[model samples]
Target: MSFRLYWPLIVLLLVIPVIILVWQWRRRGRNVVMPFDHGQEGTGFWLRLLLNSAASLPALVLAVVILILSGPTRLKEPEVKRKLTNIEFCVDVSGSMTATMGEGDRYDASMQAIDEFLEARQGDAFGLTFFGNSVMHWVPITTDASAIRQSPPFMRPGRLPSQSFGGTEIGRALLACRKRLIDTESGDRMILLVSDGMSADLGGGRDIEVANKLKGDNIIVYAIHISTGEVPDAIINITSLTGGEAFAAGDVEGLKSIFASIDGMQQAEMERTAADAVDYYQPFAIVGLSLVGLSLVCSLGLRYTPW
Candidate 1:
């Protein structure tokens, strides 16, 4: 560690010794010599040294006080800290997700992949949202991943053609997810959109509007579509507008690979941030104060007789 002074002008203290010498020389020149003696004239060298030290204690204390006023400090290196990214899983629970995409229905396969993703990314904050005709936030954005991992079992595919829970309203769902992320107001924001059907709600320029909103909030959307047909243009546009991409996964393995790809992408986003420096002047201040107090105590009884 390196030490520095805020008020380096305190270096003027180096002239104090010369000033004392000059003052003593002038005083001796003006004084008339008189033969004087004390019994201590035969004092030993050690006693004479002790007397000199006692007389010089005030100067030592003054030097320490000047050093303290200079604001002596030790410098610390800047540190890098890792920041958590906030990821909200926006899953479709409409009846269409019950359609078979692999060994199990699309909903079940997606949930499994999501669970694996959560396990792999333990350091990030995660939120869960299940959307059919309406959007439900199963878990708020939190660093605790267990809430998101345990959420899939409670959410099931709803019957289709119903206004309550069967239709795909991607627009509204996107908005809902965006609101949750905005409320968090921290970290790198992301939305993992898992769906297997085309949405009627994204028909009339709604996707563009929602994408702009997500972009405005610095939210990136990564869509994973588990479908036999091509992924919808709306999904692509929404993801691309926010600097994210849409993935088409036909099988369970493909789904896993997609999640892994996303995990890789997020890892690249982790960056080093500079941290504040720590102050290390307290101990020096304490020592300086203690020296001043000791000098006061020494002056009470320690002195030398002039001979």
Candidate 2:
């Protein structure tokens, strides 16, 4: 811990000792003041030391009072306030995801994994987006997790397969997710894309463009492909461009494991920052007050007297 003062000019009070010495000499009409020798034997060594300490009480009190007036403070070490990671869950709600791959359909199983992912990364901020032929924001990027918890039921598979939420359009979905992450002011950004099929929207190097956009913004993409056959090369390129990975989750258990892997990756990117210091002055003020009290008590019986 370190000490500091707000009003350092108050320490000028140390000049009190010089002023008192000068006044005492002037009042006695002496150029060189000498200690009064009573001619009797001096008191014992311990007694003389005790008497000298009593005479010094006023000076000690003055110094303490100066410190009190200066508003002294004790500073504590810097603290790490937050280690934040902003993650956007980009899940595919295409009709293909309705295929049963585990205890439930791929979509349902992925939703459950997403819920567990949120729980595992407790302190990080999260967003939720669902994509197919079109993209939709299920939850904005935020520290609150309640919105993510309620998303599975609202956007579950087999609701109503339409062009807006029924076909896998990876490029368009990634672009939309990137836009959302761009609007975020701070923190490490990530996109967790879950899809079970390839997309026409990824043709004509559109996928490459999306990947570069994500990489430029420092947005990592982690894709979980839940289909039976080999995962798409386009998906792998999109994820790896931004220092992320693509995984093929054949069943519910594989999907859960992929989510756990993403959790670890996000945590690995977490960073800590210094927090503001709290003001601490009460103890120093108390000590100064105690010195004043001691000075008053000493004055009652230990002060010098002209005999």
Residue range with the least summed lDDT across 10 consecutive positions in model 2 = 24-33
Task: Please write out the lDDT profile of model 2 over residues 1-307, one tens digit for every residue.
Answer: 2335533455456578656544543443212334677655543457445555666656666666666555555545665555677899888887888898777898888888988988888888899999888788989999998998887888876785685777778898888889999988877889998899987787778778889999999999999998777889889889888899999988888889989887777574534455444555677667767867887788788645554
**Cα lDDT of model 1 overall?**
0.80
* C-alpha TM-score for every candidate: 0.68, 0.79
Using TM-score as the measure, which candidate wins?
2
Q: What's the C-alpha lDDT at position 156 in model 1?
A: 78
Measured by lDDT, the strongest candidate is 1
What candidate 2 gets wrong by more than 4 Å, as runs, is 1-9, 12-59, 80-82, 270-272, 280-300, 304-307
Clashing pairs in 2: none
Prediction RMSDs, each to the true structure: 6.8, 4.8
